[model samples]
Target chain A: ELVLTADMLVEGVHVPRHVAPADFAYKALAVNVSDLVAKGADPTLYLLTLCLPKHPEPGWLEAFTSGLSNAQADFGCSLAGGDTVSAEGPVCLSITAAGTLPAGKMIHRFSANPDDKVFVTGTIGDAAAGLALIRKEVSAHPLSGEGAMREFLLSRYFRPHPPVAAIELLRQYASAAMDISDGLVLDFTRLCAASGCGGIIEADRVPLSPAVSALLEGDAFSLEAALTGGDDYEVLFTAAPGVADAIRSAAESRGLSLHCIGSIVREPGITVVGRDGAPMQISRPGYDHF
Target chain B: ELVLTADMLVEGVHVPRHVAPADFAYKALAVNVSDLVAKGADPTLYLLTLCLPKHPEPGWLEAFTSGLSNAQADFGCSLAGGDTVSAEGPVCLSITAAGTLPAGKMIHRFSANPDDKVFVTGTIGDAAAGLALIRKEVSAHPLSGEGAMREFLLSRYFRPHPPVAAIELLRQYASAAMDISDGLVLDFTRLCAASGCGGIIEADRVPLSPAVSALLEGDAFSLEAALTGGDDYEVLFTAAPGVADAIRSAAESRGLSLHCIGSIVREPGITVVGRDGAPMQISRPGYDHF
Candidate 1:
């Protein structure tokens, strides 16, 4: 089946000013591949369009393509072809990625049933914490006293490992699926909206990496960002209770950790239960560019 | 076979400052669809990425999407999906279009052989002449004494009709093919390079629209620009002598006019035969963004 998606990263907007050229290139491809992973589609080919500066620095294109090639190898996709043009504006990259799934097997964000269990792959909020660290919004904290945890959070924001090998299990088990991009609350809310269902998620049960746990040990702001700061690129999916064992086995076979954080409900909106078992007040559910 | 291509139009680079937003949007999709036509690919789907200003003018998104929808209908393709982001830089649009051709029947830029008859579809240099007129490069040419010719050239620059219906015939008969987006001379040279061949063309035989002919009757600079100015988006193909009848039939059936302008040669470069049947010297063959 034809499943196509386009994603763009604009210089100074999506990427940081001090990002390495190689990292920029890798992000360009990785982000698009992440979309395919969410759909449980086998990555096939991609078309990259670079709107670059008039006079690029020496070796910039080489580094950029090197990163792209590295990601292509990493994700099992080929660079079919691309267009490069000199933009008198800031550098921007646009990629159109194509992938294929078995007929009638693509999981949709709107297919979740009220009784389905909601699960998210990998740790959440590490990227958000990492971004805070990079921005220097939060310096040293007693919670993240270890240097290793700090480095882990920082790296998580820069690169993510999407669970590509679990596509079979996901396709078989997931009643609904989507990638976490614009924050957990927002994206999950979107998922609920699409399925015409609602969910109740336990905040404490949301998967958190040691790095993120340490970084935001006591900061409510950090907690909020973790829930609403997006860019995680982790797979958020739902499955029926009968297939829980099979889903766990599939994820373990790929050496991945999947966490069950909530369940779809008959309610019309999402309700986040805090550690106290009461609905937590949310100021904003997600990020919006417009 | 999957065929994909990308094209970008950066504000102030691809479009003139005086162009309307609607025209800008139309040109963005038209240029990319043109590439698919040259490849004899059946239009299927396209993804659009718009790097727009943070605060767009009222009705900008509607106008832009309207433009995209119009082109989707105009080119017989679907807007599968896309990404949108705000860039502080100038407005830039990147479109990745995907099409399919019969298995193992797609034409290549490097497939032309020696003695292949080289032909270009439609009249050449009209877009270039139109652009010149828009830029006031040629204000009051005696040949284009009427306003109709001026309007024709301007319209040609703003919108191009890629011969999408000619794909079946092209796949059956064409050995090599490419679109003329970056001037006839330069793209043709690239085609020859890709095929490890050369070509010779009588300049007077290069089909020219009445508007272009009238606009460049007395100005060699204008004439040269018309020949090498690019943005013409016409398919250039090479076919064997036996396929000439088929080529004519293909064009007539599609209501398109194909012009035989040159022939592939064993020699390794291009030669432009003037009206006097002598090789003419060229200074700049085409525009290079780099």
Candidate 2:
């Protein structure tokens, strides 16, 4: 038996209340899978604990189970055992996934080194932009593809994908790695804390989808949202400088967009700079459960 | 690492609302540790997930943590990681405990023998009787020393002593086992299902505390409550009849009662018999979360 367990996601707290049931189901399992992937573990077994508000709507449970069963089939995991109970308010989904690693092969958060290259896979900030769009709060921009990108961004917010491959690949090449959950900057700060290293990230090198760029327009503050607004399940990792070529080639072969935007250093805090080397201060810190 | 996780308890569900917070604190961790003992797993780590109705009253969390810390010290376990969140209703504590099994020593529920002797450690129905006492619903009985027995029964309900020693003992001799959570009858039925076997239980042989007997008087209907009410946290197991002597002596030496009340049969359903050999109908079946 490999290390197997689960965490819970309450509806109003873990995910926003407006999320679709199907997306909620998919994201719930994906978030758990992301935990396993972060540990360089493959998902093999899962136990689902569901607390429903009422007798669940038949159609909703069907759709939710469809997403759950599909994810299990796609990931080659099996349902083991779990309990279901009634709750008075929000729906709660807790999944415990179990998987094994080869002997002596476990990656952790405290292994990054000074002088390592910091990389993130896939695009960032689209989910944040989508949230802004959903809230009807983002100002109009001069970008020509605003309409198309806005729809795409909104959809991305509903179905954030976990970068499982990027995380697994880095387990072999990266010194220390973690999935970007609480925004890139905040989570990177945590990685720094865990690894006892400092990092300097070039803001301009951060990957931005067209949707994010279109929403940002020329506003530097939009980047603050990119730095603090979470739900973009991308992999952020640090690798030795010597593996840079391999990292780029491996990501390219997988059609993953891997960006090296920062470097770890001997110091102990995170510093983010623009192209001109001016430090950027995010208006809001990362999401705090409290 | 061993798999570690926990679920929290809230007042009004696991305990009565009038119960002391201090008692609730101890019960929370004790119930979770019972799950570990059921698996014959040695406690190594714990994660506490506490949701509070409000910022806890002064010293409430402190007292809770003190109890949890004490339990950890008793079991040689330590905390790893956890999260605290706020809830609008009752406080909930969820604990995930991680434990280890020596190589090839992991116990499971699927290996019961057809003729294995069914045994349970410690007495049953005491917890249910305690609950009845708390509710002030038990019939008046004049048994001597009933007051002290009631106190002990109530304490057992409020703060179950998980059979940590029984885990090691059962691992040495038992073929299949699980902690009795949803009453002995219900949990044993589940065990039979898991092992694909049936059983014949002698009603008179089921272990009962004096308090439970006093509460029931002569009516055996209360036996159903004893057999099906949840939260006893005693270890129920099955082993070859040949080991009955060793099992009895081991439990006796430990000052714990090991009662052989049933025998797993080649058939496929649970059949309970009284002295007259008639079928007994239990009022409360095993707890069903669904």
Best by TM-score: 1
Model 2 C-alpha lDDT per residue in residues B55-163, reported as the tens digit of each score: 6677877777777777776667777655565656556556666777766666677789999999888888788778877887764354457678768888889888878
- Model 1 C-alpha lDDT per residue in residues A64-147, reported as the tens digit of each score: 888888888888999888788896666888998888999888888999999899999888888888777778887746454558
Error of 1 at B221 (Å): 5.7
In order, the candidates keep a fraction of the true contacts of: 0.87, 0.10
Tens digits of lDDT, candidate 1, B1-290: 87888887888788886466777877888888778877878889888898888898888878777867777788899887888898786788888888888788777899889999999888889888877777777774655456787778887888777777777778888999998988988988999989999998778888998877766675623656767887888888899978888788878878877888889998889987877788877778887888
lDDT of each: 0.82, 0.75
